[model samples]
Target: MLDLRSQAAATRRAADRVGGLTHHLTLAAAATLESVARSQLRKAQVDPVLELASNASTAEINEARRRRSVRRGQDVYLPSWREAAVGLPNLFLRSALFSVCSAREVLVDETIATQGDTVITMTGVQLWNYDRRMFAACLNYYRDDRPLSSSAEHPWVKVSLWQLAQDLKVSYGANVHKAMRESLIRLNAAHLRIRVKRQDVPMPRLIDVAFDDGYLGRDTPAPLLRGSDTVAFRVLDSMANLFGPSDWSAISDTALHERSGLSSWLTGYYSTHAGPFKLAVAALHQYSGSICELREFRRRLKNALLALEGEDIPTDCRIASPEISLLL
Candidate 1:
């Protein structure tokens, strides 16, 4: 009986020691967790200066964080300043949708090569370099400086006609305002049909909208403005999708606005490429959407290439008989 009682007492002592060790381990684990949580909280804290600059509400900040966590990739945002540069889709730059000619009404239905076996069928009024500038200015106003949760169907901006003209470096007058309004209408009328065979993706239109002058809905025409009259410009989801990190290039605003005709087009085209590459002059001519004869285009191309060089864009034009090519 005595031996059995001694053994039982030893067992109880062992169990007590085990319980004490377990309690210490649990407390240690809880302390470590608290420390880690505090560290994370500090790291997640928002900078007050950045918060002020963005002018975002607390709910907006939380929503942006949630969206960023859920999205697969980072969002591409435009620069804050107009003079810095603007993000333009590579597909727009590489194709002949914007014709390198004077503003004229056009009806086109043609297939243009882009990526491997990917062709874009464009059908709309022939857009000019001037229109391209106007489109860029609109994008400038749609800068994503703050976390903007907009409808995926259409993201829009409201800016005065005078502001747009200033961004385009044009004198804002009654006549200029009328012309700008017409240009936006033309841009909205254009359409692009992208057929991607490799990925089996088909897209409908490039940009699917026009401007809305405040007084247009009541069956009354809005008068031409001196300034300060706002117009709503909306961009389609597909068009907005092109602004993704991989699909667009930052084009120099100064270079684009300074040059005109083929030179202006070249500014955008070369901006898409990182370095110079050889391309046939014939292909360039077709891509430029120039109505000039091939021979005449070659002459103009040479001059345009020189002008681009002056704008700090390096180029080499090889005038060989069999085929003319450019290292742009």
Candidate 2:
């Protein structure tokens, strides 16, 4: 009877704590909504099409416009016009959307990324255009990012960068523009084609134009139109606007999440429970060696992340015990 009562009491406490959190979260959400409404109402005061802060609709706007008074002979009268702006609501929503973006936790693969190392944040889709001849030609797609080196392996006769640049210099003399134009022309020639092999299978007529850029180390954006010899035309934009920027409005929430890398990043992070587990493994190495051996320590780390660290033992993982997942 005592054990039953203790369990019941523990359950009640958990329930109460959860209830408190829910209430606080709801209140916070309500406050945020109210704030947004107030901001929109303030903005509506000046916008002609937006419903006035008074919540007046299109009819009200027409009536207000019609009611405007003009001076007749010596008599003069005026009507006060309220603000109504259509674009303000959209601006508010976009601000909210970006808030969501900023709230997401940053996740990184430790194997590929080091702690404190800078990694590319894929907040949105990157657009690229085909125009490597002159980097400046792709200005429309420029965004702030350090240039990264992109390389590809070549055959026996290595074309050193210095040699290529020197050859271009001598051939084009002082006219850099003309040299670039002629180089692009040479790339366009059909005779310069490559064959790509995939899975040891030969593919017909493949264009092996590798792109290299200096933007990864530089604190400025690389030109988006830096396509290689095979690229003819291209443009970059949010994958959500694959059809075009004008079509972006039609993209649904579900579609946006899938197209954007953000959702995938979250789902992967949570299911994997990578960050916490890593910290746990590091902790185990500090104390007991045998009973708390490295293998056993890893088991504890894995179990903890699944929310079953002490409750349910995991069958397949670095650690088999459930006790590891308890955030210990």
lDDT of 2 by residue, 1-328 (tens): 3343455445555455566677566555555555665565565433211123344453553444232322222222122222210001111111111221222222221111111211212222111111121221211111111111112321212232233333222232223323343333322221211111111111111112233332232233334212221223221111101111111111122222222222212222223232333344443333111135566545543434443222332221223233434534
lDDT of 1 by residue, 199-274 (tens): 3223454333445454343334446354777676655433443433345677777656777888788778766766
TM-score of 2: 0.15
- Best-matching candidate per lDDT: 1
Write down the TM-score for model 1. 0.63
After superposition on all CA atoms, what RMSD does each candidate show versus the true structure? 16.6, 24.6
- For each candidate, what is the lDDT? 0.59, 0.26
Q: TM-scores, in order shown?
A: 0.63, 0.15
Lowest lDDT sum, 10 consecutive residues, model 2, at 84-93
Prediction-by-prediction clash tally: 0, 24
Candidate 1 yields a Cα-based lDDT of: 0.59
Clashes of 1: 0
